[model samples]
Target: MAPLRPFLARVEAKTLLAVLLTAAALWTFVGLADEVAEGDTHAFDESLLLALRSPTDISDPLGSPAIETAVRDVTALGGVTVLTFVTLSVMGALAIRRHGRSALFLGVAVAGGQALSHFSKTFFDRPRPDLVPHGTEFVSTSFPSGHSMMAAVTWLTLAVMLARAEPRRRMKVYWIALAALVAVAVGVSRVYLGVHWPSDVLAGWTLGAAWALLCLLAARWLSRRGDIEPERGGP
Candidate 1:
């Protein structure tokens, strides 16, 4: 039988890139947090606020009602809850189908990201925006948005899983693109709705991506160790 040369090569490259990116993200996140601690408030957060408050001389063609509705919907469920639930549920289903190892990896990755988000919020205790009307009421500390983090982690994790499933080449690319779009859209929505500062969303995405990559690497290691067998008709 011929070896799956292309498949193996892709996996090696993906894993290496994931690790490098994850490390870079962590370094950037730490540096940003330190800057914020040193009272650097002129970052993306302030800029985003300015953009939101900028006058729209020309009325939005979509109208205020449409914009408001979209904002309300996006901020309805906090990003954390929505992403966590979706990722966990999908992982759980996969586990039940005998892909226990992959599921475990997913679970750990999400949990780690959540923990980091919570800790960062507590550490920074950054206040929520009061300059604009918030579409939804929330009381969590707001440095790094939980919703943004979850959205990134969940969608990125799914993308990694899809890539590993050995699906059709075109389909794999489509899935990865779709997941990336959703993750970005969710983060942007949080900012547009005045629920999270732009900096918060940016930080969330960085941490989320880092966590997902770490999780994928861990999952790959487990698979090699015979700890996580691919499911029948998997991916």
Candidate 2:
């Protein structure tokens, strides 16, 4: 009798599926961003960005004062200070746990994403949105919102790592979903704040998600091959 083949559980299958879906999204957004950079998507991008604001008052955001305050607080979650602290803290924990490979991967993935964000801004030289006053100041080009990209990279990267230690499939789903929620909120805040075009945030989300998936897939493969510390179990 032939030996039975190994059957992947739902979680394992979903992880592989996520890589494929994220890749497609990454390519789709790359094309859109290129269209934006070429000035082909300006009408669409501007319309979407403006739609999120008050129709009568361009300077005013659509939300009430309290909601606006909440949004600003959420947006701050994607800021450099917050993301950096979170990254360092998570990496420190991983290192202390003797998962050096995970720590290295997290550091490399985030740092590389930051470098890519900077290079992309320079390469595109796209100006910030000017149809309305910006709620937040910008120091770099606006092709891809740095806050959005780094937020996605940081949250999604952490989500993937943290999810692996989850023994239950539902918990894994929740972790990834929570990460996606934060990333989406950050991107929306950039547009709401009148700092980035819709396409810029979309590009950031897709690219950052892609980068996170790449890191996760690499880590998984390495662990299987005994090149890194395998997941020790528990969240």
Candidate 3:
């Protein structure tokens, strides 16, 4: 019993951090939403969105055509088709590994995140940036960039699962950091493409991160109760 005290302490600390981070993300989202609703972010959004384009010609993006192409490729990582493929592939792998429960959980988390993004866009009904020509096509209203939110949700959820399957703390951090990097890149791409305001990307990143953390916490709780498989070599 005494030997397990340190392990329990570590678990508690991690859980507390997750909770605090989730709360912070949610709070930030609310603040951003309020600012957007009140049009307070208009100046900031326009300046940043315009900065990505050529000063003399707003139609052309700042970089060479190659860079623009590369950015478009990166942005595609968050597109519906790409994200859906990645999600299905990961779920399939999990099921094949005999972790059907985790696969189902992954599907639920991603689907819920998608629905949240969709409904939020509909609710806000914010127009896409009109400051410059949009470099890509878009269909939904653009309060929260769907690409940014889903990138975070899908990649981060997968990262959490990958981290769970590993026992090394360093590896866990690596997976999560990589996921965050990808999410950030996707969000920035939305702005660079002039399809979404900077605030829209910010809102998406925060809300998506909050959702992913909530799912991670839920998975931990379920694992503790033996409702799901525990992390590798975890108590």
Candidate 4:
């Protein structure tokens, strides 16, 4: 019991940090949403959106054609098709590794995020930015970018799950960093392509991250109750 004290203390500290971080993210999202509804973010969004495009030609994005193409590719990583494929693949892998419960949890988390995105977009009914020509196609309202939201949801959720399974601290850090890089890239690409306002991406990122953290907290609680696999150690 004495030897276990330090490890338990570390777990408690990490859990507390996760809770605080999740709360902060949620608060930020709510604040952004309120500001957006009040039209306070229009100037900020337009400035950032225009900065990424040529002053002479709003239709032309700044940078070489290749860079624009690359950004489009990155943006696609957040699209529904790509996100769905990646989530399915990860779930399949988890199932194969006999982590079926984890896979189910991931499926539910991703699906719930999708539903949240759909409902929020419908409720807000915000229009996409028209300051510049859209560089890519969009099929939904753009208050909170669906692509950016799903990018964070899928990538971060996967990262948290994978990190839990990894024994090495460095590997855990690597996974989280990589996931964050992907999510940020996707959000930036949305803004760069003129498909979404900067506030839209910001809101998407915050809300998505908050949702992912909530799922993580739930998973930890479930694990503690022996409702899910312990993975590397008991929660």
lDDT of 4 by residue, 178-228 (tens): 999999999999999998999999999998999899989988998889877
Clashes of each: 2, 0, 0, 0
Q: Over the stretch 129-168, how does candidate 2's per-residue lDDT look in tens digits?
A: 9999988767888988888988898999988876765568
Candidate number with the higher TM-score (1 or 4)? 4
Q: Rank candidates by lDDT, best first.
A: 3, 4, 2, 1
Give Cα-based local distance difference scores for all models.
0.71, 0.83, 0.91, 0.89
Candidate 3 per-residue lDDT over residues 1-235, each given as its tens digit: 9998887777787798899999999999999999999999999998998888888898999899999999999999999999999889988987887778888889999999999999999999999888888899999999899999999999999989877877888898898999999999999999999999999999999999999999999999988898777888442
TM-score per model over all chains? 0.80, 0.87, 0.93, 0.93
Decide which is better by TM-score, 1 or 3: 3
lDDT for 194 in candidate 3 is: 94
lDDT per residue (tens digit) for residues 147-200 in model 1: 777777777877676566544677767867877777787777777777777878
Report lDDT (Cα) of residue 69, candidate 1. Answer: 83
| Best of the two (1, 2) by TM-score | 2
Worst 10 residues of 2 by lDDT: 1-10
Question: Which ranges of candidate 4 are over 4 A from the true structure?
Answer: 1-11, 233-235
